[model samples]
Target: MMKHGLDPGDRRRPERLTRPELTARREAMERFLHVATPQLDQLYNLVCLSGCNVLLTDAEGVVLDQRMSEADAAQFRDWGLWQGADWSEAVQGTNGIGTCLVEGRQVTIHRDEHFHTRNIGMSCMDAPIWGPDGKLLAALDVSSARADQTERYNRLISAQVAQTARAIEAVFFRASFPEARIVVASDEGGDAAMLLAVDKDDLAIGATRAARRALGLEREGAIRPRPAADLLGRDDDMSGFDKAERAAVTRALARAGGNVSAAARALGIGRATMYRRMARLGLGEKQP
Candidate 1:
């Protein structure tokens, strides 16, 4: 920060957005707040009595929402932990919120680890929240100015911050594709959520970053729509299962004299599902 002319000894607080500027900034976060605000409340209740403050920031690290104990309000404001404060690494230097956004990972800047000498008394743990497209969206931070807080305690709190961040990312991802079915790709991947959004036809419409990487697709944009089974290496048109299904459907239709509903009932499947299967198998159109 010295190269950028920021002095470690400087005690000035980060710049606060003007009233109108803050208002506009918040209005921009309406959708994000829809998914994050409630979770932040739950997290706040779990940690507020511990003398900590929870701050939610936009991708640029501008504080967008926060929850703090009223009793500790004065000191938190004095430290500039409030709505409109810009804590981007450009201004704050090596802090939890900014660094997490930059690194795309969870981070903890403990007391004395802060770049600004003035901020050295507070401990901050933050995790990056990812958007549906695998881009950095925002940060979730838990900061404590308590004198008795220790590194050991920060580790435990850090896990909560990370978990909540993932929860926000998952919810946002699902909301991004409401019409699709979200499938858990696997349970073994460590924090990075492995999920896939499959449409009604079983095509892969979207995937979480971890799943995209595992499936060898682009990480942050429109994935060329493909059969989920194809991507999973199960798209064998000539496989025994496909042949068997085609034969079964063909025989059911023949037995029912081309009546689709009767064929579906004989196959013990719903009419719509049976129609879909027949269409998928390229079977000739039959009467409903």
Candidate 2:
């Protein structure tokens, strides 16, 4: 079974961030909302479907825009929250968005993470959004009533919140620079070999600084255009590969449970070729 607090919504874990540690995150959130508008609205709507309240905060931990259930909205308003409310721990004490910003990782804080007694009825999960230069961009948070009987409901909402955060990131990335390929580099390890972002046309968009270094580029460059087979080591047998290579690699990796060697063998390719495919094609560490 999954640990309660290590990865997701764990209630049994030790407390992570102190009150003062959240100051910087709170400032960042203050700045993010100043510049984000229409897209922020879309993000709010995306999380609303999960029956959770979504908050868009800057690095500083201030609440910019909030979307909540009808009753919850009324309660929040009754609490005197307006458009410019600051929910940072320094101001409001520990909470999901605030703590995640301070911790700088994805986390789930069941009611207990809240510093205030009133907030204990909520379960909140959050992930930090990052910018192109890898600076903290914003905090995406989802909060729902913990009194609900179903753990599945909380899990579903948490997943939706995470997806919404990614969607906002994708939209922000594309909107900021429509021409730039938005390649996703893995958040873990900062590996030069992994490429995370892919364009709609199935082309690799951006490569991480580490990846650029591995690719032998002096400076950062585009995600690089290479056939799916080239990355997966099937390039040598071009005649045997076709448009389905991407889908094939994806499914193979999934079936192999993320074992690249198994995926390669299943595809009749050497393990080395599989590695090349992972890097060249920009597949990150994820099994999918």
Candidate 3:
């Protein structure tokens, strides 16, 4: 293990774990990789190319997958950034991948945020990736020395890695749990707040709790608990099911029905603008 100096106030941290706890986390990751699959390897490769070293950890901060660029890998290894490592702040001190995961958000913990002596030279950015029902899935992290990087680019790179990680998660989820409902929660708003679910065949089912709330529903309205093409203008192909997919949905609904209120509600659209769309689409009587 690498050792370094503990600045004033760093010596008294109670949250730090002993060496054995760290060793346990390290061993767990080794066990996880022993049975790794192709999809997991793909996820690791994609993350590795995204301009940051990526570390996939469990709910606990045990590193499951790690991929760094060859040059960075060498440097990281010199810093003792090996594959089987305990990423938790409690074990290795306050670094981004562990601490951001511990706090459950996208976090940047630069050098001084470290609570232990060994972590003081590293700068890291970590984003928490959540699974269905909002369970923490894994984390995407980038780490380097403070002397070699800048704040703005670091944040931008972290965000990019986070989104890439999320996409990998989406693909994995859709494939593994094909029948289970999948809801995407976006940090983007406006039309970007759109929510749509899919059935086992990947057809549009309906929205979830957050989707209904984002669309301004008082409670879970008529957007059935099952897969239904209740959304008025929704196409048979369901291309309009995402925010980027909405324009097509709106156009299709235009051809299907003219009633704005009727169509909007079905499409997870808010009521106030349903009338406006009805006027725009020149709709007649509402669909039954």
Candidate 4:
């Protein structure tokens, strides 16, 4: 709170968005809201069943969408935890949404952890949502007025919120790159949520957060539109040469509409060589 220039003991109510300001903010997030609403609704239903409220907020912590029963909404409105409220660290101090945005990670602000006295009654967990380009897009948060006042419970809720946020991010990433081929890569003996969007030439155009992490891509948007083989550690693999050969053949075939002769010409290989490589790679020519 001090870094954002707020005293921990500050007792003033946070600023609220005006009617026009709220509408404008919502409009700015229209694309994200549209892509995320279906999954958000599913998560909201599950959380509401447990008497919790789920909300979607932009990167700046402006609430875009919220889900809660009318009764619950009414009771929570007194704390300004509704739609159009600004929960940025600059405004709300160290609450879940605000802290998550600042840290760029999942967080749980339980009870007295909130810097504001008014927010002390609320316990909330939040996860950061990232776009296909690995940019922070928004935050997904679940809060409850009657939350379990236990550290273990807060940790459980934090994990749930993080998982929910990852699911939403995956859906958004796939939707954002509908025509790109999605490749799922996992660590040995472990399931991975990372999804790489590859082009016909097997060039990576985008990736999920998990994919970026697995590939050790530190710079944002740096791995995108690069050779997937290069970024995915194919150079050190035993079958790297064969895999590259197969990828080239597959790309040429796809680009030529599966016409063997055309694909061969595009790849600068004779028809016989194309046929031999295609047979080896298990690709069949399409009749044209």
Candidate 5:
């Protein structure tokens, strides 16, 4: 903070983005914003009675959208918690949304934990949201300026913020691959959004961060397209793969009206390979 020439006692804040700049940023993050706005609304509906404001900010910690009770709007706006406000750790110093974005995790900066004395009255809880590509995407925050709020209660709200962030990530991931099949890689650590997008050949097209780590898949850019079964370690047992393959071939054959050539084409495979697999799997004799 001192390096940024910030003096906690001075009570100064960074300049917020102008209307045009904010509009441009929103346009850049339109996809993420489109998916997260509705979640913030839902969260607000559940939290409105608690006298708090729910905010969604981009990776840079600039507030893109917010939901607050109209009764407290003027007060929160005065505290710089409104739309277009820049609360990055570099700008605001040791706050909830900004610090969580920087740390890439959940956090709560309660009351006097704020670097600036003017912000000491508010408590903020936050969680970092990751993009479909497994990069830092945004921050979800719930800020309460209510004087009677306690740190214990803030922790409860903190959990809600983190859950909402995961929901946003899952929605964004599914939206990113509308045509692909989404499969749950694991129920464990699913709060990290362990999801995978697979293609027609059962190749893993994309994976959420937790899914990527669990599967030992690609860390950046497009995945190299590994088989989902292989990633799940199910390939160690050919019995399972055979059973699944048998089912797939049977379905394709049925769909093709029992024509081997049509079934091979439908399965996106060569006729020779299809016949060989059918024989190995003890499938019925092939048609002429």
Candidate 6:
């Protein structure tokens, strides 16, 4: 508020973007908007089941799309929560979308957490959606009027929102690198799945956020387009053949639920061939 020259007690709405400015921003985000529109629609639909409103914004926190029920539309609009509104930290203070973008992670801002007094009745959850290059592309936010609820319940909802954001990031990553082979990796208990993108030459071109974290790529400062073996902790050099074989076998097993015969049939290869390849690739004991 001090940076923006606003008083602490101010309840005035922030300045909105002009028509031309909004148009330019939309045009700049055309590609991302195209890729995110369908996913955002699905996300909005899913969240609406719980009477929540969904908002999609670019990295700068300019609203691109929003979904709200008729029951809450008027109230939200009155709060200036609509398409093209600016919700950056500079503008809206400490709201969910702005704080998530600032922190580069998921956040839950409930009631009094909001800097603006007028927003004290709102509860919001937001998570950043990252591109294949590990850059912030956009954010996904779900918000509703504050309600009396246990902290545990609110945390559960926050987790759900973060999961959905990760799903969007994964989808966006796959779309950005459609030609790359996607290798699914999971945590110890196999509760979460992360995607690693390997090029035809067995190089790791990209990874989803979860994959990056699981593999410790960020800590290692591993240059992107690096060797897949480096991230996977494998010493053997991965030939093109090895990468292709592993990808095929992993996908087949995933589809077949670890049934070697079914996986072979799906790949149009003999069961013996599948078993031999799986063993060679060190994937024989790996469960999908």
**What tens digits encode model 6's per-residue C-alpha lDDT throughout 1-288?**
677664545776655678888889889877777777776777777667556778888899988778889988887877777888888988888899999999998899888888888887778889888766666778888887536644566577777777777777776778777898887755353523377888887788777766777777662333368777667766557776777678778988999898889999999999778777887898874334
Q: In model 6, which regions exceed 4 Å deviation?
A: 1-4, 146-153, 185-193, 216-223, 235-288
lDDT of 5 by residue, 233-268 (tens): 655435866867887999899999989999999999
Per-residue C-alpha lDDT of model 1 across residues 76-134, encoded as one tens digit per residue: 89889989999998888888898888888889999888999889889999998877787
Clashes by residue pair, model 3: 231-266, 231-267, 233-253, 240-245, 258-283
- Identify the superior model by lDDT, candidate 4 or candidate 6: 4
Clashes of 6: 0
Give the lowest summed-lDDT range of ten residues in model 5.
Answer: 232-241
- The number of clashing residue pairs in each candidate reads 0, 22, 5, 0, 0, 0
TM-score of each: 0.83, 0.51, 0.53, 0.80, 0.86, 0.74
Query: What ranking of all candidate models by TM-score puts the best one first?
Result: 5, 1, 4, 6, 3, 2
What ranges in model 2 sit over 4 Å off? Answer: 1-51, 78-82, 182-288
| Local distance difference test values of all predictions, in order | 0.86, 0.58, 0.55, 0.80, 0.86, 0.77
In candidate 3, stretches whose alpha carbon ends up further than 4 angstroms from where it belongs are 1-52, 179-195, 200-288
lDDT tens digits, residue span 158-251, model 3:
6656665555445544554456565553436432213556664444555433455554433433443433343323345434334334454465
Q: After superposition, which runs of candidate 5 have C-alpha atoms over 4 Å from their true positions?
A: 187-189, 236-247, 253-279, 282-288
Ranking by lDDT: 5, 1, 4, 6, 2, 3
lDDT of 4 by residue, 77-124 (tens): 877788888899888888999999999988998888899887788889
Q: Weakest 10 consecutive residues, lDDT, candidate 4?
A: 184-193
Model 4 steric clash total: 0
Off by over 4 Å in 1: 187-192, 233-288
Q: Ten residues in a row with the worst lDDT in model 1?
A: 185-194
